[model samples]
Target chain A: MNSLLVSLRVALATMLVCVGGYTAVILGVGVLTPDSAQGSLITRPDGTIIGSRLIAQKFDKPHYFWPRPSAPDYNASGAAGSNKSPTSADLTDRAKQTVERYGATQDKPLPADLAAASGGGLDPHITAHAALYQADRVAPARGVAREAIVALIERHTFSPGGPLTPDRLVNVLELNLALDRDFDPTSSSK
Target chain B: MTAMVFILLIVGGSALLSWPLGRYMKWAMDPDETAGPGRQKLDRIFASIAGTLGTEQQGWKRYMVALLIFNIVMFTVSFAFMALQQHLPLNPDEMKAVEGSLIFNTVASFTSNTNLQHYSGEASMSYLTQLCSLMWLQFVSAATGVAALAAMARGLAGRKMMGNFFVDVQRATFLVLLPISFVVATLFLFGGMPMTLQGSAHAATLEGLQQIIARGPVAAFVAIKQLGTNGGGFFGPNCTQPFENPTFWTNAVCMVAIILIPMASVWMFGRIIGRVRHAGVVFAVMLVFLLAKISGAVWFEQAPTQAFASLPIEQATGNLEGKELRFGAATVPLWAVLTTSTSNGSVGAMHDSLNPMTGLMPMIGMWLNATFGGVGVGMINMFIYIILAVFIAGMMVGRTPEYLNRRVEAREIKFAAVTLLAHAFFILVPTAVFAVTPWGAATLNNVGPHGFSEMLYEFSSAAANNGSGFEGLGDNTVPWNIATGIVMLLARFIPIILPLAIAGSLAAKKPTAQSAGTLGVEDVTFAAMLIATILVVGALTFFPAAALGPIVEHLKFMV
Candidate 1:
């Protein structure tokens, strides 16, 4: 009985060791990477800070690339999706909301994924096909000719191995950053 | 959708793998079975260094303590390696530091054969970090699995003490890892997996010359990662890499290699115990489940998903989203089932894209704790469950349970039962709540029954300590990250805890005399009874989730 109790203690010690180890590691990270009360502010070429990586801002403008739609929205730190079964009413409701959101985005209806999220709401890219649907609206909105817009869209399309649905896309975060770098506001539509 | 199905296939395929390997072990471990010259050299080395020091006759509690301490130390070191990777000598390109949370998950995951990865391989970690921290764990964890395998082998072999924990861990590493890794790694390198740290040539992205890409020492780690049944990747994109997974044949070979030793331990079981039929029964049972899930996935693949149904994608080629064109519907799940179902937790095909029902298959495998395996531990876990089942069958028949001189007494039965029930309790109760609750419901990525099923499946898989995801659960948040971490720890240890208790109690019990009323667990009757008990328990526990997830989702897609 004493040995059993001792064994129990040993197990508890082992568990504690694990817990303590993690706590220490976390503390180390806190010191090294130091949690910021504020997220790093990013900006357009205009020097105006837009937002932070920690925050998910809605990108509905035609000229800006879009991210995967989020449930509970794409913002809210540590926010997540409803773990609903495919047949549940909750999902249908959410989809309906997403569909409505998608409808407001452009003349064309939304891509299914455009209205949904990649499991980790942290997903940053939209599929090319989904991205291209926005090209028409963005081309005119930016006063860039449709052909030039098409060319930029073509430039962003990528295939890693041309395998596994080879259409996995340019991440929205990187793509938007590129837009800020290359797009010149002084260009005339004429 | 492709990711999810591949997960199921790999899981189910892993189960199928256990059988042949089990049968082979049965043949190989016999004293009468001739060791080829090479095997003799291998065996000799294990004998010398492993020292066979553990009193195969030591009492159970002591053995359990040794095993516990051994694993704890291993996890600690593995965790430290990740946390301290920047300081580690081997790190190339000064790999970025892994967040403690990711380290916590991988350490817990790999030790448990769960192999859950929160970070993308290339983006988050360096080659040195992958090798020392991730790859080292893969090797040692495989040893840990075989250690459990050997412990269970002790119970079956009718040893008095639970056997030497150190010997088992060492021999498993040497006897299994050294040779198996050689074959597997060589095959991978031959199959075009790269071992060098030279960055993959930067090429134009489909649209244009884009980001400077990173590829790593994939060949070396890819071999052990899968063959060791450690499912982490050289690159975060994982087995999705052409360099890592490569051609379909390479994927198949790697998949088979991972399960082969874990499954072979069963044959080792029969030989060590001098009972060929006993090993065969376990091997057979694992096969049945594997085949069932594999076929289920194939059938599901042939059917188009609603998401696809709404799209122009052809069903003939199967759902392509998140699937590697190299492996196709057939190979990915075969690889997936092999990886996730065995505690390998590695992914060659993205499980994020699987149709809800097809996706549920691997979830089922993980939820089962891949009882058929985590390389070494899978066979051991099933054996422990078998003991519990035998004890139950004996109770129902108004007799005592006796196997190889160990009495399956009331105490042993109680603890083992607690372990089984506790695991089920964890999976089912949480799943039921998630299905019913608003918070859980709001988390669904897909709508309809299929989406809800995925949510339940994700929690179940995590809670079960199986790391494969539906890729549907929007995890990485506080609620899930914390809940899952807790679940993974519990799922990994609780089963181990009760078994060790059972071993202790059995060690203390006097061998009961065999009589007409004593149940012979090795007979066809007992084996069949055991199988029925396992299925019923599994079916009863998981059927609701299965109905809500895979069964409902399958009908939705097919009908």
Candidate 2:
């Protein structure tokens, strides 16, 4: 019983120090860098919040670059992957449908990430190749030359700059926003 | 190619950092240190706060009692908090109280340092519950394991008493875990992870769709979640979530954080017992196994996903299903191996969508359960393997076994064997029961061998206290919650308690003088022996199950 009493005291003390003190410190320090601490939210010139730079937004329209397929439809309230095993028939059917949607064929296949659902369901970026693959569609819809779309993708493409860097990728949301600013699809030449 | 380089960087960077961190841990955990005036002041403050609890030196039995009682209190308090979350302060989203069984499971899971989540954090839990209850446990439970290891190391070093449990816990939390976590959390915040008390943000996307993006005290929660080997996520899909792990640099840092302290723990153990060379040998053995698993996972994932074979999409970039584009294929597999190897089960990619053979690598890590393992407990698990190795080697040479000048009798061997047996039994028996019954089959997200693998992986994770799962299993049901909750309890305490018992027993014996035939444990040959013992024991127990799941899945894919 004495041990139990001591245990209880220790537990409370530890919680106060950890949950109370430690969290207070982190939150306090977070005040200095409000932008990153507030989810790196992107805003319009009028200060209306659009989305986070880190988070994916749905972009099914032809004038925008598409992210990877999202199993939860980019629902941030609850994230999930398809959780399908490699041999599951559901996995195969979904992959095939994704390919068909992309107009992919044996002769001209889509980028792998373009045909797959991301684990988190909110992947913001797509491979540079995947972005370029959509150039034929995005350019026509925006009434811009294909070269202009290609050049825009190249400008937005970035790697973390190391031997350890993965493939250069473009943020789908950022690129599309830039497209609206630069190309102004509503005022198309066509 | 860049994937391999990143993996090597993570591994090599962790290994390099562990040395200095281990040295610091030695000074911080030592009870009798009169090192400096600064440390003396800190110790004095700790003593005043703890009163008798910090001052009293305990034997193994007393230490174990205090540890158990403390954990029980923590569990009870957190359970009540989670159960009544709707009424709690800071619940901005008006999250309801959790269901009874799930609350029990979540409490048990966190208390044991096995953070197997049945529910998604953003959807199910409020911010108050996430920080006060779950994140609090992440720090203390990890400290509990480290404290236990410290006690055992004291005993093995022939100290008169294991140091005070309360004191050690405080030191681990305040000195070791807190400082490191603060730096990591700040780094994560700058890397674009959110640290807000505001609920999910309402965003109007450029597509004019309303997107509810969840954000919370995630930076603080995730820092300890990785550093403590408590792999619970502030959101579902763990580090795969952009808010939790915002960039490739953050992902790489998370991978390093997962293994950093666990690797440091081996050096700390050696420091405690004054056996740094032996610790190096043990560290080497763990590194070899870890590297092999990493390589296997990376290599196996290079093959096109079998499910996509009939599709016209190009998979020449390797398996990309369930992988984030920024991290790409190689980093995902590398992260999977690293997470499982350290029992830090946070995933950058979904384990369910890994190629069949790549999926086997994490399982292999869990089955062994000692390749760097979980924080302090990893070293404790390795101690069991070392005991078994020493005994077998001694018996073959027609001599009694001795480790570090103390004899290893039947008492020690019996305890070690029971610990190992309990781990296997908890995993295999529960897996068998669940797989054949509605309890498992009804919950499967895949059919055939893959379904079996999911069940097997859950049990293996529970028993190893690994907490990573195949994620395809619908395991939030009563049976899974209750059974795995029970398994986590048993697997965690048994392995911990028995090792302490062995250490206590060894402490009682008088030390013998070192001789030429003291069984050189700090050499290449001993490492090989230790490796063989781990593999043979692990293979004998788990091979048939592996064959039934991933191996069969791989062969079927080939056909």
Candidate 3:
């Protein structure tokens, strides 16, 4: 009984130190890290808070650049992949759908990222190659030159190869948001 | 190639850093240190707790009892919180309470330091449960392993009594895990990882679709989870999830944290036994095994899948089917190897998507379970192998089987054999049971060898207390929950108990001077022999299972 009591006391004390004291200190530091510390929320020009800079958002319209396809229907509350194996029929169907949707041909290949859901199922970025491939479609819808759209893709393109992150990828959400903020077709036309 | 260098640097850096970390651990493990006048007040409180617990000086059995009581107390509290999560505070999402069997499995998994998560963290567990129960157990359970290792070290040194359990647990928590976790948590928080009590945020997607983004006190859980080798994730996608591992630096920090203490504990073992050379030999064996796993994973994962060979893009770019583009082929394989090597099961990429050979590497590591394994228990496992090796080598060469001047007798060998055999028994038996049963067959997400590998991996993970999954097993059912719960319990305690029993038996013997006929454990030849013993033991036990699952799968993939 004494041992159990002492164990309880120690457990409570350790919890106080770790959960209360330690977390309070670290959380204070987290809150100080700008918007990123709290889900990386970005604000639109209308003062409304949007999603994070990191998490992918749905961009299905022709004018907007699309992020990678999400499983669980882009529900952040339940972030998970299809977890389908290479030999899985569902995986094959999904890949086929993605290819047909993207209009890939023999000469012009779709980036693998476009055909596959990432492990997280919430990847914000797609390959630079994938991003550029959509330029023709996005350019016409936005009433922009192909050259300007390619430039925008280039600006948003991040090399995946890194001492940190290594690949040539573009953040789809940030690029689309930039397309709205910096390159308004209405103002350019006017 | 740069990814390989980065991984090598992290491993090399952590190994070098373990030297100083081991010194501090040495101080913490020493029971003879006086609190002194400057620390009288704090020391008195600790001393009182020790007194209350009757933890002054205990034989191994008494010590085990104390440890069990402590663990049971923690387990009970966590189980209660999980069972009553709906009524708990910090549950902003109004998540319901977990059912009985799942609660049982979850608590067992965490308490065993296995953390084989059957449920998604974000959608299932409330913030209160995540913090108070899940994160809380990760610390104590890991500290328990470190405490147990310290006790075993005491027995190895031939101490008449193993040190007080309360003191060992307290010191391991306060002196070792607490400080390191504090710094790591702070780094995560400041590095843009979320640490909020607010529920999921309502946000608009680029498509103007409304979505609720889940948020919680992730930074704190993420820190201890990795550092403790408690690989449970705060979110379903695990470390690969951006919120848990935001930047490249955080990913590196987490990767290094998993093996930090386990590697350090090896050095501490050599320090405790007063034989750096012996520890060096053991460390080398672990490294070779770890490197072999990494090479195999990287080699296979970088090749295009045989199923996808006809695709020109896949042939040109290698297998990107289930990998994060940011991590690419290079870091993903390294992460798989390191995570499994330490039994830190947090995944940065989908293991289910891996090629057959790539997926087998982590399984092989788990089967060995001592290639720089979990925080402290890993080195203890290696020590058990060393004991077995000594006994075998002595018998072969017509010498007296001795390690650290203690004779390797029948009782010691019995305990060691039980420990080794129990791992295989728990893994292979349960896997077989599941393979034949409709209940187990129902859980498989794939057919044939892939499905066989998934089941084998599940039991291997549970037995090894390595929690990463193939993610293809539909294992959230009641039978899986309860069955794995029981497996986790038996597999964890049996290995721990038998090893400690052997340590106790060894501690009671008087040290004899090394003679010409004594087996030299630190010799290079003995190191080679020990490596062979570990491999041969693993192969004899698990090779058939491996051949049935990964090897056959690989062969089929070739055609």
Candidate 4:
């Protein structure tokens, strides 16, 4: 009877320790708020609502802005990364194919990160170079003068030092929203 | 490529140094223990405590069960921690908790001594989550291993009042892991794994909007991850990041810490059983195998890959896949050798970057399960093989075999063979299945021979209970997560269970001293025989697969 009591006490003690420790961890990670999430709004052509700051959707009209690579399904809940290693041949070939599809010349140097997917596959921004490549095509579609679009870019481009070429980049999501209001009021991409 | 070289470098040092250091540690602790005053003091104190606690001596069978139960409890704790992370505190960034399917794999990986990682370190985990769920379990899992080590000592030393499970675990953590982890963890922090959950790196990308980069409390977790021989890194990049394993000293420290327990505990085992030279012999054979591989990796990586040279790309740099700038080519292989040899999956080099020939060393190491393995369990596992080697030699010579002063028999050998075959099966069958399947082929990070090598390396790592990968496998998929989890469970427990059962059964055996006809275990001949057993039986099994993978790659690059 005494032995049985000791065994029970030990088993109980083990269970309690495990439960207590486990609870501390669950509360530690699960309860935390996403306070750092940066929220932004999209204004439609008439200055009404659209969607989010980070999500990526299609830019259908051959005249609109393009978003960076995203693994998420337009910010769907079950969205996930392709889970491919950066060194994978499949990814390397895919990146190369994408570059070719963008009509980049064979000799043009591509940004390393541009060719590789982000670990989460939901990277929201592209280098100024990537944006600039699309700028020529996008400006012609909107009937906006090159200098005017470049000036809007100059105002919005972020840089720690003073003005620089790569520094005058624009956010795709924000830029697209601005395009909807400024011209093409009937644009439907949200 | 840089990380694989770092691994090569470490293997060079560990292979040359571990045996001598192991031998020295044996002599340093006690040259001729006529039973020192300190030993007596520890003994008396423990005995008194046991008496007061009303501890009853149980047979080895019951003790093994107790140890397994303790391990299961640890498993439960880690899993619960993962599930509950969402509601828990210390999440300053307020990151959402991990999903359950991912949580199951993560918990199993950490607890089973295989540290395979599938998630990003900074974004997915909170500070409270990192320390409590992952780091805390590292502590208990390491302690559970050492408790089993003490049980092995009892089996050999033939103690009537075998050591307490709780006491052994507490002592291992308090005396070994906690103190060492404090110092090592601090060093890793000094090397720049983050200690605080201060604001993450802030910036705007070329776009005017603010972009956030992932950073967190990695320094504290890194110490145990490396020291416990758990290679699952604090961040997704594993050890390649400057913050996680930064600088040369920290690199060396990580290497040293991974092998410390496995190396030092051999001396501890010798001391407990009163056979210093016996431990030295086992340590020596392991060193020879390790050193040869390290040199091979170093040589292999310095040579340029054939495909890279043939491509119009500049061929000056060697083996560049997934290689980080911080450590460069030489440092990668050094980290590789240490991680694989110690049951750690922590990688400094991208296994994808390794020269095809270079990948073989780690693949072989994981395939055989390092002779000295993860922390406490590693050294004990080596001893089980030594006993089996002795029994085999004795049977061949038509003599009764004795380890220390115990008879070897069919029952003991049966359990050891089960453990051996189970471990071996884990390495071979998994690699074969992956090789024939599209799931494995599609995940290939590099093409040709090295790709197959990386898949084999993953199985070798998982089955050996080492968690570090070649960083090549697309391990995030469901098949890998589930399959590797099962392998980790079986590989870890099977090795542990059989050794423990042997200990229990051996405790029942009456001591039978050696006669003229009986084989002598103490002499140099027996030592040579033991070395042969490890190299021939353990290593030879993986040779053909290695030839197909790393060896094939070597020939390709040369051609």
DockQ for every model, please: 0.05, 0.74, 0.57, 0.04
Clashes of 1: 51
Candidate 3 CAPRI classification by DockQ: medium
Comparison by DockQ, 2 against 3, better one = 2
Candidate 3 local Cα displacement, residue B184, angstroms: 1.1
Please report, in order, the local distance difference test score of every candidate based on alpha carbons: 0.58, 0.88, 0.82, 0.61
Q: For every model shown, what is its TM-score relative to the native structure?
A: 0.69, 0.98, 0.96, 0.72
| Per-residue lDDT of model 1, residues A1-190, tens digit only | 4333332343333233322332233223323222111122344466544543323345665566666655434432222333343334454455566566545433455555554443334344566776776676666767767787667767876653344333445546556656655675336241
In terms of lDDT, which candidate is strongest?
A: 2
Candidate 3, A84-128: lDDT as tens digits: 555555666666677678777667766667776777777878888
Q: What are the RMSD figures for all models against the true structure? A: 10.0, 1.4, 2.2, 9.7
The candidate scoring highest on TM-score is 2
* Models ranked on DockQ: 2, 3, 1, 4
TM-score of 3: 0.96
TM-score for predicted model 2 compared with the true structure: 0.98
Is candidate 1 or 2 superior in lDDT?
2
Over the stretch B76-110, how does candidate 1's per-residue lDDT look in tens digits? 76677678777776554556677666678767766
Q: Candidate 1 lDDT (Cα, whole model)?
A: 0.58
CAPRI class of candidate 1: incorrect
User: In CAPRI terms, where does candidate 4 land?
Assistant: incorrect
